[model samples]
Target: MELIEVADAVQLGVERMGVGPPVLLIGGLGMPSQIWELSGLTAALVDAGFSVIAYNTRGVAPSTATEPPYSVDKLASDAEHLLEACGITEALVVGYSLGCYTAQCLVRRRPDMVTGAVFLAGLQPSPIGALVGQMELDLIGRLGEIPAQVRVFEQLMTTLSPAMLQDPETVSIWRQLLADGDSLWSDRKGLHGQLAASFEWIMNEEPHPEHLAQISAPVLVLAFEHDVFFPPRTSRETAQQIPNSQFKQIDGAAHGGLFSNETNVVETIAQFCADQRHRLDGGGSRYASP
Candidate 1:
């Protein structure tokens, strides 16, 4: 693991393995890259003859939190800086959840540096509006108390996906992450600033749908059949928006099930990448869109 300083003195820690076409992995919101370590997905990808790079997002473990405010655009810029630091001019970007938003912003801002993208359990921009609507600001106000906040966050994660509650490893990692973020969460000023940035980025900014037509690079939109946060329809809509995109729904999986069910996830991605490579080598597109 190595730390690369990006914009705003955010020290982003990245881990790289294998040697081949670069595949940049971006984690979901509030979770550190270490979750990937526990899932063994990183190792599996590395063993599949592809170079893999996974990094901690800003405010996550091993990555320095930006001062008070940070937007998706800022996070995207941080990714760009991290890629440059790693000497990666172009790569196949893979993002999960909030990281998917960052990926969209990166491709929009710097299309030249992206070869292709894979969005896992991704959502449309308006999804955040639904999330904020469901959230009770009054409850968020009381979240200033660390213990209560931690409990709430734990319950929230469990409610989002019961699999989280059943998986001890996932629960443990989540608790540890919450503990790490305790200070930031307790500081009302900081928490409010971060929430404001998140809300602004999701609601105010145009959805990636507008730029989907502009994305020339092939995209694979992967979703779990039982994702609580993002339904299968979300993935279908995302694929439909992109001119050159395909969608696949993995059965018997929840939001985080892609990690738990690593074999299927890895195999699907490998096949997609292999097909794309073959197409580039004069093989016509053979995979049908979902």
Candidate 2:
């Protein structure tokens, strides 16, 4: 992992691994690059010929957090700036949860910046989704750092499928990961800011269904079959709103199941990235045009 200073004036703790096509992995709330490292997705993608760029988002220091008045658009700008800093002209962006929000912002704000994008477990703006966001914000605000970390650990525990949890080995690894404590979360203020920023994005910054037409890149929206955080119905419907976007719901995955059910998630994305690379190299677009 290296700390790279981008044009935004913030130095992010970034991990650029392997040697092939660049794939930017944008993690969400309660997730940093370390969690990806633990999930083995990085190595999996690496072996599949992707040079993964995994980085800790704001608040996860060694990566500095931005000051107040945070918005998902600002975070999106940070991501694009990071790419320029790394000298990567274009890349395939893979985002989960809040990271997906940033990806959307990037594609809409700067279409030429990304070759393709895959959104996993993403939430769309809706009345019900708004209420859920409020509940989550209140819950996060009530907890301090350690408690917040524990809360996240418990939340993630629920993201896995029941059968996965039934396996003793799986439970053991998850339990051990949680037992490490505070390291799982970044600074308290950063954590709170991230939550607030996310809530704002989901509630307001998230475009209307019709607004999705502005995005010009090839898009793939992945929904966990049972992701309560972002329902499959909603994710699929959101995909439909984006002209010519692809939508796939993984059968056995939940909100956090992509990690526990790593095989499919990693494999699916790897194939998409490879195809996109091939299409771009051949001066042809495999994905349908907008």
Candidate 3:
């Protein structure tokens, strides 16, 4: 674990493992960087022979928080600075959920720093998601504050698939996880900022749908089979827009598939990175953003 100074003297909590080709892992809205480890993706990636870099987004614990109503572009800038600070010229960027918005903006703004990108369980716009974001914002404004337990329950219901919630054993495990609670759920300011960013991204404020065509790096749009937010249809549309992109869906998984199907997710990502490396080694040239 290391503290990386990005912009505005804000220090981001970053973790790195392995010493192979670099792979930057960005989590979803308010997602702790430790999820990479808890899901076993980081260790699996290390075994696959790739340097893995993961970090807590600003406003999360160990990382300084700024004002609320954060924008996706600002988040992307932080990621750019992190790469610069680490002296990594190029890497395979992977973003999940809200992090997908950040990755999109990063690739568009700084193509030279990205070898390829993976949008895991996200990148596609969701009308339902936009509505949900607005409701959350309104609830925050009207109620002042929501109970932490309520928030946790809300997340569990929305994040996991109906199938997962139905299984008694799975629900039992999730109950324990909910009991432990997440730092993001307790941080009012950070939670608000993340919600604002999520809303903005869903509304297409930062990297709008048209911006997808401008991306120059090879992209993999990985969608969970049961992801209600970024469904496979929307994900396919998102992939078609990218000049160089592929779309794949994991079976029997939802938005929370990163945790529910960690092994499969890791295998898919490892294969994508391996293929990208082969392409680069074969003198594949990426297109420049217009």
Candidate 4:
């Protein structure tokens, strides 16, 4: 991993591999670039002949945190700068969960830089989601840091499919893996910063109509069948807001499908990107450079 300065004193750690059409991967809230590798998506994408660029977002280790009160728009700006620094004039962008909100902001803010986008475990504005963010911030303010075990339990309970939870072996494995958190999520302050930003964005800044419709790039919103946070209905609604966006639901998968249903998610993403490249070659839409 190399640290690239994206802004004044703000360096984002990035990993690049393979060579073909460039695909920028923006991870979820407090997610480090390494999760892509852990999910097997990075290697799969590399083997499938695409240049993969993944990075640890600001506030994550090796990346300058700067101050907090960050917004999704700010995260989107970081992504834009990262791409520009890499000399990628345009590329396919992929965002997972909170990363989906960032990707949406990026597509709208800088259409020229994004050829197409994929929102994995997509996000749509929800009163409930906003409320949850507020609740998290409130709890942090009142109780200090939430215990790691409690956080892990909440994560597993919310993200795993009901079927997966029912499987004792699967549940046990996940329990162990999550209990031993990775370096990427070790910074409590960074995670709280992200939580604050999410609360602010969802409550105040998320576009209602005109903003999403302004996005001109072809988009694919991939939804998981059992995602409590972003169910198919929510993902489809988000897709409806964006022009020319496609929504596909993955059966038997939950919010954590990116890992649990790795093969399907990887195949779907690879196919969508490949199709976009083909479209660009055929003098298709405005996906080509101006």
TM-score of each: 0.78, 0.85, 0.91, 0.91
Candidate 3, 74-155: lDDT as tens digits:
8999999988877777788999999998898888779888889999987776777787788789888988655667766776
lDDT of 1 by residue, 1-290 (tens): 68888875568877777766667788776556766767666776667655777887777655676555567788789888887877777777888877787888889988877778888776554464446523633345566433556445643463235655677887677566555554432234434434545566666644556777898888888877767656787668867988888898877666666555433876777666655553223222111111
Clashing residue pairs in all predictions, respectively, total 0, 0, 0, 0
Instruction: Give, for candidate 1, the lowest lDDT window spanning 10 residues.
Output: 281-290
Runs of candidate 1 exceeding 4 Å displacement: 125-129, 132-197, 205-208, 277-290
Candidate 4: where are CA atoms >4 Å away? Answer: 279-290
Where is model 3 more than 4 Å wrong at Cα? 205-207, 278-290
**Whole-model lDDT values for every prediction:** 0.67, 0.73, 0.80, 0.79
Cα error of candidate 2 at position 231, Å: 1.1
lDDT agreement of model 1 with the native? 0.67
Q: Candidate 3 — what's its lDDT?
A: 0.80
The residue pairs found clashing in candidate 3 are none
The residue pairs found clashing in candidate 2 are none
Candidate 3 residue 76 Cα shift, in angstroms, is: 0.3
